[model samples]
Target: MSRIGKRPVDLPSGVSATVSGQMVEVKGPKGTRSFTATDDVTLAMEDNAITVTPRGKSKKALQQWGMSRTMVANLVQGVTEGFKKELEITGVGYRAQMQGNTLKLALGYSHDVDFQVPSGVTVTCPKQTEIVIEGSDQQLVGQVAANIREWRAPEPYKGKGIKYKGEFIFRKEGKKK
Candidate 1:
């Protein structure tokens, strides 16, 4: 038995969820999100809560049970509170700024990197060294932050580059003179 799958996802006030066949849709003040579970799991809505149960005792069904439950939970949270990711740029000449819907980054490269913001996501640069990504979809927010950080990942020596705000970079000693 899956502990997480057994627990029903409670809908907060002002949030509503509906399940039709293998698809579940959640609506809240922020936005609406939908998730489609595999046939191995069944989705049911009752008493302001949604539950996921395996269709059979097969391995695939059991695997989808817990995953479907978590996916439903994420849908609720996404429509209610949304998701956010923060990135910090560290270097002598590295910086980030928002130009309209585009994010301009200077990571000591020959040419500045221009990142076009995708729909349903908002990119903001509060400070030259800070980048904030916000969206109703958690996966999109994380992916956008990762794409920006990929340009200049924090290096082991001196730790100069872009990284998550609270990320830690292991330092390496320099060669002896």
Candidate 2:
């Protein structure tokens, strides 16, 4: 048995978790989110918490049991406090601006890159080069941030590009003749 799988995900007041078929729905004061359990993983809600159990002792069951447990936990957290991701634009001419629900980024490119903010997520530019993305769903927030950063990932030489705040970009030394 997986230690993490055996543990219960405590639900705070006003939070409710429901398991239906392979889908787990977590509703709270903030919002509601749902996730589907993987194969061979059984989810049960009790004591205002969630317990994940595997059907058998097979390797696949064990692997999915832990994964499904964590996924449910994340969904619960998402409804409660949510998640956030911050990105920093580093370059001479790099910057970002929020136009309504769209984000415009200038990453030293000839043309600017425009990205639309998905529902349930908010993008804010505190500074010209700082971008903050916030949402309840961690996976969606992360994926959206990644898509924005992918436009111009930080380069190794000058470390000038789009990167996550506090992210370390190892610089490669030039050839010393």
Candidate 3:
């Protein structure tokens, strides 16, 4: 039995969840998101909470049970509070700015990097060194942030690059003289 799968996901006020077969859809103030779980796990909606259970006593079924429950919970949270990621540029000349729907980045590169923001996800540069990513889909928001960070990852020595706001970079000792 899965501990996490045993707990039910409560639907807050102004949020509604519908379960049809293996698919569960959640609609909230932010947006509506749906997920289709594997056949090993079953989905049920009771009152204002959603629950998940495995079909049989198998390893795969048990594994999916917890995962399915988490996914459903994420859906509910996504539609309500949504997801956000913040990135901070750390370098002398590194900064970020927005031009219409494109994100212009200056990361000490030869040319300014231009990142096109996707439809569902919104990218904002509140400050020259800060980048804010927000969206209802958790996966999309994270992927967009990762793509932007890939342009210039923080280095261990100088720690100069684009990285998450709370991320830490371990420094290495310089070569002996």
- The numbered model that scores best in lDDT is 3
The sequence of per-residue lDDT tens digits that candidate 1 reaches over residues 42-110 is 899888999899999999999899999998998899888889999999999899898999999988989
Off by over 4 Å in 1: none
TM-score for candidate 3? 0.98
- Quick one: ranking by lDDT, best first? 3, 1, 2
Q: Clashing residue pairs, candidate 1?
A: none
Better of 1 and 2 by lDDT: 1
Cα lDDT tens digits for candidate 3, 1-177: 789999999999999888999999899999889999999998998878999999999999999999999999999899899999999999998999999999999988899999999998999999999999999999999999999999999999889999998998999987998
The CA lDDT of each predicted structure is: 0.92, 0.90, 0.94
Colliding residue pairs in candidate 2: none
Per-candidate TM equals 0.98, 0.94, 0.98
Per-residue lDDT of 119 in model 3 = 92
lDDT of 1 at 155: 95
Task: Name model 3 segments beyond 4 Å from true.
Answer: none
Alpha-carbon RMSD, each predicted model = 0.8, 1.4, 0.8
